[model samples]
Target: MSDLPRLSSSRVPTPFIAFAVLAILSLALAGCDGQAQEEAKPERPVLTIKVHYAPQTPDRSFVGTIRPRIETDVGFRVPGKVAKRLVEVGQVVDVGQPLALLDDADLKLQAEQADAELRAANGVLAQAQAAENRAAELRRKGWSTDAQMDQAKAAAAEARGRVIRAERSVELTKNNLSYATLRADARGVVMATAAEPGQVVASGQGVVRIARVAEKEAVVAVPETLVARAQGGEAHVSLWSEPGKTYAAKLREFAPVADAATRTYLAKFSIPAADDAVKLGMTATLTLAEPASERVARVPLSAVFNQGHGPSVFVADAATGKVELRPVTVKSYETRDAVIADGVKDGENIVALGVHKLDTAQKVRVVSSLSF
Candidate 1:
């Protein structure tokens, strides 16, 4: 007993030692719990965009072709073999310019025949007139009967009718001979030629295709949904070769029916300010600008969040640095963005990415895309 060492005053007893250990353990456990709580409520950094509202003047563009306002297919008025094609494709021609010539041998022969028939009719008339004069002179001497005088008058009248018909035949043949040449009715550029030097074409067959360059137009196929808007909207045209230059265009014609295959309406927009540079068959872009439409917010597509309820977005509070899942009315989705029709006020910060991991009232650090 004596040999056992007495505990010093500076040393604690077993109970106190055990109590101290327990208290230290409790403090350590509380500290760990507090640290875990702090770590769990982390400040998540997210990319965000500022919301801005503007009148959606949606401009729709369509590929089109520059064309002429009036295109006509001219052909010869008389049937004959094509002798020569005077104009080639892309040749500029004026009104009354000969485009093609037909073989005029047949036409010339018919005219000669008509002239010979007229001469014969004139000779017969002369003979009849001389015979009638002789008959009248005999009747005056009382040597001619009344029947003979009547017969002479009828013969002269019939010969005069034959001469009148022959003269009309000569005029018809001359007109037909003039029709052997195909002429341009309007000043334009020739687009195509169907008749070669030796092709035989009937009357009214397309021999040459000419497009009037006085007025140019942009032709495009518009979707059925935008037909009405396109007609009332202002149009502008730009050529692929000259993108910087734009010509004001006006809607001139719209097809009443939709095309069967494409389900689109054919629209022709006249370019009153079109210059010579706007050539036929050039690729063009037609843009239609609508009047000020409804105001909407366009947000990045990744900012939209959906969890079986509808489309919503996480809007960050500027003051609290917290995010709130907001229900938004999405009007439409485009290639890279979604158009928000409503439920988002102007000048709000919206989380632009990582919306799936966000929750209501979650604290976040709003970072701009430019910061990167």
Candidate 2:
């Protein structure tokens, strides 16, 4: 009763059995932990994002050319040989400036002869008048007949008429002589010269081409599809030769009918002032600003994906760090960009690159690079 029986040597101890149960439990727990870790891990994908931004203003682009506001073909009123050329090509000439001279020797001689004839006619008229007065006096004194006096008066009248005719002829001859010299009607630059010294030109023949130097204009032919974009307002113009230099112009007018051959409308813009650098036939580019509408977000054209039904973009939510496919409406499409009218908000991040390979409701790692 006082002493317990000795335990058998081959019997397992209680401490050892407790240790085996604990070891089995530990192995089971480790397997469960491994499964949970595998399930908790998320599939990460590489992606790029572009934030939606509000456009400061809308810009419209157009192709155009530069031209003079007033152009004319200069010619002489009378035909003659070109005796002298007064102005050279590209030379600026003022009003009343002599541009060219024609051979006028014959005209000058004709004018001188007409003047001499006029003087002779005047002398004959004076003599006839004196004789008519004497004949009237003789008729009153009964020395001459009334019919003879009347005839003398008729002769004097005829001589007076002849003198008037001769004076008019002299004036005509002088005018013809003056016509040989060609003069500029307005201040302009000589664009082209069709006649040279010693070349015979016909009346009204185009001898020189000139463009007015006071007012300059820009002429642009807009396609039918884009003609509606041009409005009567301010526009920015640039020259191809001069990069980064811009000039301000006002839209003057647009032709009502489109050109039959080109199917484009002609638009004219008035430059503020005459610039020496600006010349006729120079190429130019015009940029007109579009009217302001409701504020909307815009993104690059590459960021937009056309999914048959509509346009859409991938948006990454910052709160949950998740990417979701969202549909958007395109307000306008430009050369290299698109303006989103709806389906996105300001400051929202959008997937720009690697959007084609993404799935709906996927987690993405945003890169630091930004797109224009």
Candidate 3:
């Protein structure tokens, strides 16, 4: 009977042991489940992108030339033959500098003839005065009639008027002779000469072209696509001779019509109070900062994952350190950047590369950040 009690007690202990073993097995299975779940969730190092809405800068490398604002064509004021070309092309001239002379032989002859006429007129006036004085004395002596005295007075007055007219003719001849010489009307550089020595030129005929150096400007031919941007944005100029230096420029004017030969718009930019370094015909380059057509954010191409649905990017939340798939509208694409129109906000971080293999609830460690 004592052995039976002991066997029964042993059997009871076996049930407790079995219960403990079951409890241990359940705890082990729970631990394995927790480990599997942790393994299933991926934690990969990913490259990230931050949303940005920066105004794009337009590239302006158009070739240009420095030119004077006023290019005047100067010519002679009198009709005559060019006796001499005093100034050559590229020669600087001051106002009233003699440029050329006409043949003065005929002018001299006309002056001489005027002088001879004046001398003859004076002699006639003296004879008329002597006759008038003699006639007045005869009238006083009662031997000369009133009609004869009056006629002598009229002749004297006519002779005196002729003398005055002759003097005026002499003055006019002197002025005509002075007009034979062509002179510069303004201070400027002679760009071109049209008349040569001994060439007959009429009045107001263009003999030389003068470029006024008072104000300078940069002239460039802009492509049709860039004309609007050129006018709207700020323009800068740099001379090829002094590549390191730069000059600020303003949009002065633009040609209304396109150039037929070049098929480009001619734009002129004025340099305010430019120094002497900027010379006429100097080669230069023009740069402009253009505004974007639409304000948008830019992202990398690798960050986008379409998968038949609209394009989406995996954006990482800074607070949670977790990634969320965000739906974005791409405005346009570049070689390395994608212009996002509506999907992302500025300053938001996004996955830059390897977006296709990512899960919606995946936790990621940002290895590096990229700016696009």
Candidate 4:
């Protein structure tokens, strides 16, 4: 009995040994499963993005020209020689300012002649009145015949008619004399001068060109595709000469029809009266604001992947954490971004960086440290 106990008694059961090995294997498997669960977590993708929301405004810019608000062609009212040009080109003038003078020597001579004729007519009228009174007195004293009194009355009536005609001639001459001086009807700057000293101008001939100095306008041509968006909106204006300064203007008018040659619509913007720095014919840039109702998907210019078939972008779904190849139609592109006309919405996130390696339906882990 003492030798048997020392000799390890009876041999252990094979099934029992097998069960012990199986228990150890189960414990090792459990530890491996715990490690796998931790390692299976996904890594996030790195991206930079701007949230898609209602666009604050789509500010579009276009080229334009500076033009005068009001342009006028100054002309003479009567025919005569231009004695002198009182204003020069680019001269600022006020209302009722004399712009030119016509020769009045002939007019003065005519006026003098009319005055002399009026005085002569007055003398004839006085003589006729005296003769008529004398004839009436003689008839009353029974010294003159009725036929003499009738003849004197006829002579007095003819002389009074002559005096009235002479007075009208004098008034007409005075009016013509006053018309010899050409004057401006409004405050403006002279843009052109067509008359000079000793130049003969006919009535209604343009002697100068003037434009209102206080009101300025910007004239721009909008593309036919964008004309509808430009009507009745405010515009931002920048002067070419003064690029740093900007001003606001209101869109006042747009042509109903498009220009035949250029296929663009003509539009005008009313701008504040700029100082002398803003000269006529200076170039300007106009920026028109688009309405907020137009919704569009946009992305950075770099995010777009160019393919022979069409343009596309990389989209990452948050739920699945997978990248997808999405086709997009580009509506328009600006300096740093592009506007997708279709095929996207406001809430979806897109891969902006490292998109070149992405494929459709590929699983990805979003790394928290790299997520933008």
Candidate 5:
């Protein structure tokens, strides 16, 4: 006992040891085999969807801004330094309301000069009339030669022409003086102010922006593909604040060319019955709900499986419990779905998910049905 090494097991025969090791290995392998068989036995479970009939609604919705049917830039008719801004931005103005004033010291001086010229012309004309009358009287009395009478007549005619010119000059000077005061030409709300007091502006350079409140228009940008439909389709406008109320709108105008950066066409729609709540610059939703361009089916994006054999979906046979990869014509791809224009009619079952691992001969147990 003192010289021998200790042992954990009793000394056994070689044949008995080999037999025990074999039996343990066989049991371990059998357990693994049983697990693998269990894992591979059941049919693959998949999610599917049954196609159903639905009346399509073609909606082309765009976010747009509410604008006025008539908006114009108001400016001075004559160039001058602005003396005073008579009205501020956001002020409601009526027709002929003075908006701003230009420095009119020079204009007044011009008017006075024109008046003086008119007076001088009138004096000369009066003198010429007196001379022409005397010359005619003398000719009638045979006391003046025809040559002298003709000369007097020519002088009177020239004086009369100068008077006419002076009168026109006076009228023009008066008009220029009145133009110094910029006035509103229509009833509107001032939206913007460009010129301030003491600023010089050229003739017809806008100093204020006014929007006429007679009618409201919804202005939106349409993509190139929907340009024609937006121009022809029935449009409805609703404010972001007031989602429940919608106003009927008609297409008033559309840009012939697309924007260079966005490739969108600007469109304007007239709202005939817009109330006071439809304010300028308010955000609105412009929906172009045209009749269904063509009846078609739309399915979830996951249902499509394109694996080098073109785009297809695994269509399931409910009676046979098997699936087949059927080709489909995809019209368009949306954010969450694809529009199917030519394939997969109503009342057909198709695999909605897990199409990557499915084969035509393999049977799939339907776990759930999804709605598109």
Candidate 6:
């Protein structure tokens, strides 16, 4: 013991040290294997939807304005400076009611001139008739030549024709004078005024826009895609002022062509039961329910996944519990859902959320809607 090195209490045996190192290395290796296995595991369960196809009767809504069945621009029949405007925008007018007045000074002068001419013609006719009677008496007495009597008779006839022409002129002038006062052709409401007092307007130029209130209609711009639908669909109108009430409507008129700027068709729906509450120019909502033309399924927007390969969704197999990426043809997108036209059949399960994180042909557990 004195010659050899003494064993220290803190010193460990070589065999024991080797065994401890081996045990620690084995434990570390085992931990790494477990972590790798965990990382390689399949994804958790995903929310899904079981699609059901049915007749697709989409409802299309459009913002429109309440209008009249007959709206026309009314103007004076005679050209003149506007002396006064009797009706304003939004004024209710009856048939024959004066809407505006033109300056009648020239018209009055014309009427007076016509009347004077007619009076002069009458005087000339009276003088010619007396002369013709005298010539006939003289001829009958053999004191006047036949030529003189014939000339007198011709003069009388000419005077009578002149009088007739003058009378017609007088009537025409009177009509023109009356035309200077623009009158309403029908009972309507004034929508707009184009001519003001003292403004010169040509004959037939619009002075006021009148809308007949006997029948009501809704004028709306429909999307080109929905033009056919609007023509044959059922329509309902709701006024912005009276939201609680809705009136049934029928398609009255639809434009054959689309507007140049908006590429939309102009459509008018007639409301037979409209009342006073449905005033002209009021805001209205027109909803058209299209007939079912095809079979389709509605799915959530989140279910659709697009990765530069158009649109696709993950569908889970019922037997294998595995998901397969399926390409879907989306017909249209709604507020919170999408209408699928093709590429998937009825009774197929589709992943709803977290679509971007999934891979094709992966296994997933199906979760209920409440748990999700």
lDDT tens readout by residue for model 4, 1-372: 656655342578779889999999999999999999877745546474543644445678888998888999988777999998998888989999999999999889989999999999999999999999999999999999999999999999999999999999999888888889888998888999998899899999999899987778889999977776788555788899999888888878889888999999899888884777777789999988765556666678877877786888777766677776778888888898788877666666777767776666456654422212
- Cα displacement (angstroms), candidate 6, residue 48, comes to 24
Mind giving the per-residue lDDT tens digits that candidate 2 earns over 171-282? 9998999888899999998999999999999999999999997888889887876665576434788888785888888878889999999998889988886477777778
Put down candidate 5 lDDT per residue, 253-329, tens digits, no spaces: 89988899999999999999999889888999998876555666788899999989878988887667788888998
Error of 4 at 307 (Å): 31
Q: Which runs in model 4 stand beyond 4 Å of their true positions?
A: 1-57, 120-168, 291-372
Cα RMSDs, all models: 11.7, 9.3, 8.8, 9.8, 15.7, 14.5
Question: lDDT tens string, model 6, 163-257?
Answer: 99999999999999999989999999999999999999998899999999989999999987887779888799999898889999999998888
Candidate 2's C-alpha runs over 4 A off are 1-57, 139-149, 229-233, 241-253, 290-372
Clashes of each: 0, 0, 0, 7, 0, 0
**Candidate that scores best on TM-score:** 5
The count of backbone overlaps in candidate 2 is 0
Total residue pair clashes for candidate 3: 0
lDDT tens readout by residue for model 3, 80-112? 888888889889889899987888888899999
Native-to-model Cα distance after best TM-score fit, residue 291 in candidate 1, in Å:
6.0
Error (Å) of candidate 6 at residue 43 is 43
**How close to the true structure is residue 360 of candidate 4, measured as C-alpha lDDT?**
69
lDDT of each: 0.90, 0.82, 0.86, 0.82, 0.88, 0.90
TM-score for each candidate, following the candidate numbering: 0.59, 0.60, 0.52, 0.55, 0.62, 0.58
Model 2 CA lDDT for position 244? 83
Q: What is the lDDT, from 0 to 100, of the residue 111 in candidate 1?
A: 99
